[model samples]
Every structure is written in structure tokens, then in C-alpha cells.
Target: MAKDNSFDIVSKVDLQEVVNAVNQAVREIETRFDFKDSKSKISFDGKSEITLVSDDDFKLRNVVDILESKLVKRGVNLKALRYGKIEPAAGNTVRQNVTLVQGIEQDIAKKIVKAVKDSKIKVQATIQGDQIRVSGKNRDDLQNVIKLIKEMDLNIPVEFVNFRTF
Candidate 1:
């Protein structure tokens, strides 16, 4: 029996790395001269959300830019940061919530499958829960599929895992 070469595509972010980045951003925010008396603050809930509070719109933008740079330095994709509505908080402050993307959604998985199919590549793409599995007889075809998917501009970060040939 000829076995297939297969690999899995998954969207996963290292929360620990994000936490470290958040910590770094907080430190920078606290010590920066511009923020010395601006009452700027950044907080992470240790899960999948972050909150940014600043005295006004200008400081808020600065804080967001700082956090984004830290996240990119930590290897987190900038697209993974989804910003919520910037609303006014109590005591003359502006607040914004940032949501961290964690996994591949079903819609994205479907899109991957569609792209693979559309490319006329000789591979099978299956949506296995939160991940997509691609398998084919030709390893080269599988490699091509990976390349094609990477070229697509999906809104989340994806990782290729469990590459196996049997």
C-alpha cells in the first residue's frame, strides 16, 4: 500500500510570548518621557485580550504603536492583533481593547481548502476541526500547496505541522 505525504495547517499563537511582549510594552510605556505624566497604561488579562488606557487620543495611538512593535519583535504577526472600538472610559480617559487571535476558524479553513482546490494542485485538503490537513501522493505537490497557501493573505498566522510520509 502506498502511503500519502501529509501535513497539517494550524493557526496558533504562543500566549507566553505575547505575555512577555505585553510586559515589555508596559515597561516602555511607564518609562517613556512622553508618558511620564500621561497616565498611560497597558494590561493583559492573561488569556486572549489586552486593554489599553491613555489620557487622550494621541497617547492612545502611541501606546498601540509601541505594543505592536513589541509584538512584531516577539514574532507575533501584526494581523493577529484585532482592535476593538476605541471608547471613552471614566475619569477623562480613552480605552481600547485588543483581542489576540488564537486558532484557525472554520471560515478560514474553508478558504484554504478552496484555494487548494482552485489552484488545480494534486492534493487533498480536509478541514479537521480547527486545522486543515493536506495530503497527496507527490511530496512536491504538497510542497506546492504549502507555497500557494503561504502566498494567500489570510488575516491570521498559520503554522505547518505534523509532516509525515508513510
Candidate 2:
């Protein structure tokens, strides 16, 4: 009997890395001459949102750039962040919120399943809550599916996990 090979596709961000990134950004802002006297700050809510505050639009953009660089250096995918619109805050400051994405959205999960089914690969794909599981009797077919998914422009960062053969 041929046992199935399987893997899971998921999109998740490491919250601790995000926190570290924010801390690095804050430290950079404090030392930068332009931000020395300006009110620039980055704060993380520890759950899913990061808040950025600066004295004006220019400083706000600079703050965002610093944060992004730190995140990239930490190997955190930029796609996992959803940036909210910048808005005016108290004391003539500008503020923005960045929401961390933790899972594959339902619509995207459905699209992944449909694409797998349409590809004519000898595999079965099922959407299980926030992730997709793909399984097949042939290990090669499973690898092919992974290649196909990698070639797709899903607009979200995905990681393949739990590769198993039984």
C-alpha cells in the first residue's frame, strides 16, 4: 500500500522578531540627528499591532523606513504587515498602525485549494481553517505542488511546514 506524503501551507509572523525590530527602530530614531529633537516613536502592542508616531509626515516616513529595514534584517517578511492609513494624532503628530498578519485569509485559502485542484497534479488539497493541507501518494507530485505554489503570486508570504510521508 502506498502511503501519502503531505505538507501544510501557512502564513505567520514571529511576534518576538517584530518586537525586536520595533526596539531597534526606536533606538535608531533616538540617535539620528533629524529625529533627536523631533517626536518620533515606535511602539508594539505585543499582540498584533505596531504604532508609529512622529512630529510630521516626513519624520513619519523616515520612521517607517527605519522600521522596515529592521524587520527585513530580522528575516521578517514585509508582506505579513498590513499598514493602516496615516492619521493626525494629538499634539500635531502623525500616527500609523501596522497590523501583523497571522494566518492565510479564507479567500486566499480557497484560491489555493482551487489552484491545486485545477493543476491536474495527483494531489488532494483541503482548506483547514487558516491553512491548506496538500497530500498525495507520490512524493514527487507533492514536490511539484510545492513548486507550483511557489511560482504563484499569492501577494502573501507562505511557508511550507510539516512535510510528512507515511
Candidate 3:
């Protein structure tokens, strides 16, 4: 009898890094000449959403760029920041939503399931909550799944953890 091997694949973000990036963006907005006294502001609404308010679309875009730069500096992937459509608000203002997506979205999770099924690998894949777990009889098969996942560009950062030999 041989032991089974298993691992979980997940996409997660470091909240602290996100906070650091936001802080840096605030400092830049204050010092940058273009944004100085521009009446534009950046704030984190709730815990996972970032709201950017500006008088015009151009200035709003600039602020978004500044925030993106900070996120990059903090080693957070740009794809993880999902931006909503810009809309008009009262007092002649424009607002946009920046959602910090920490876990696997529905679409991405489905894609992972489909890819695993199409691979024809002899591993069992189950979606547990927000993540997918893969298990198989051979260690080599599990490693192969990991390699296959790495080869695909899912546009999300995936981490492998809790590997165990049953």
C-alpha cells in the first residue's frame, strides 16, 4: 500500500502590504505638485474597498496611477486590484472603486476547475470554500499538477500549501 499526497492552491493578499501602499500613496498625493491643493482625496472605505474622489477624470486617473505605483513597490500584483467603472457623483465629482480582491473569484475558480479536468490527470480536485484541493496516489502526479498550474497565466497569484502525504 502507498500513501496519497495532496495540496491546496489558493490566491491571497497581504493586508498589511496593502495598507503600506495606501499610506505611501497618501504621502505622494500631498507632495506631488499636480495633486497639491487639487481637492482630490483617497480613502479606504470599509476594510477591503478603496475610494478615490477627484474633480475631474484626468486627476482621478493620476491618483489611480500613483496608488498602482505604490502597490507595485509593495510587491502586490496589479491584477489583484479590480477597478470599478467611474461614475458621476454629486457636487460635480467623479468616483471610482478599487476593490482589493484577496481570494479566488468565481470565474478564476471555475477556470481552475476546468483546467484541472481537462488535464486528464489522475488527481481529485475539489473546491473547498474559496480554494481548490488536489489529491492523488502518487507524489509525482501532485507535483505535475503544480507544474501545469504554474505554466498557465491565471492572472492571479497562487500559492501551494499544506502539502501532506497520506
Best by TM-score: 2
Question: Can you tell me which runs of candidate 2 are displaced by over 4 Å?
Answer: none
RMSD values, in order shown: 1.1, 0.7, 1.8
Q: What is the per-residue lDDT of model 1 for residues 39-73, given as tens digits with 9 covering 90 to 100?
A: 78999999899999999998999999999999999
Q: lDDT of model 2 at residue 75? A: 94
What lDDT score goes with residue 115 in model 1? 93
TM-score of 3: 0.89
Error of 2 at 59 (Å): 1.0
- How many clashing pairs does model 3 include? 0
lDDT against true structure, model 3: 0.86
Show where candidate 3 strays beyond 4 Å.
none
Candidate 2 residue pairs in clash (backbone atoms < 3 Å): none
CA lDDT, every model vs. true structure: 0.92, 0.93, 0.86
Compute the lDDT for candidate 2.
0.93
User: Across residues 1-166, which tens digit of lDDT does each residue of candidate 2 receive?
Assistant: 9998999999988888999999999999999988877989999999999999999999999999999999999999998989999999999999999999889999999888998999999999998889999999999999999999999988789999999999
Across 17-68, the per-residue lDDT of candidate 3 in tens digits comes to 8888888998889898887768777887546899888889999999999999
The C-alpha TM-scores of every prediction are 0.96, 0.98, 0.89
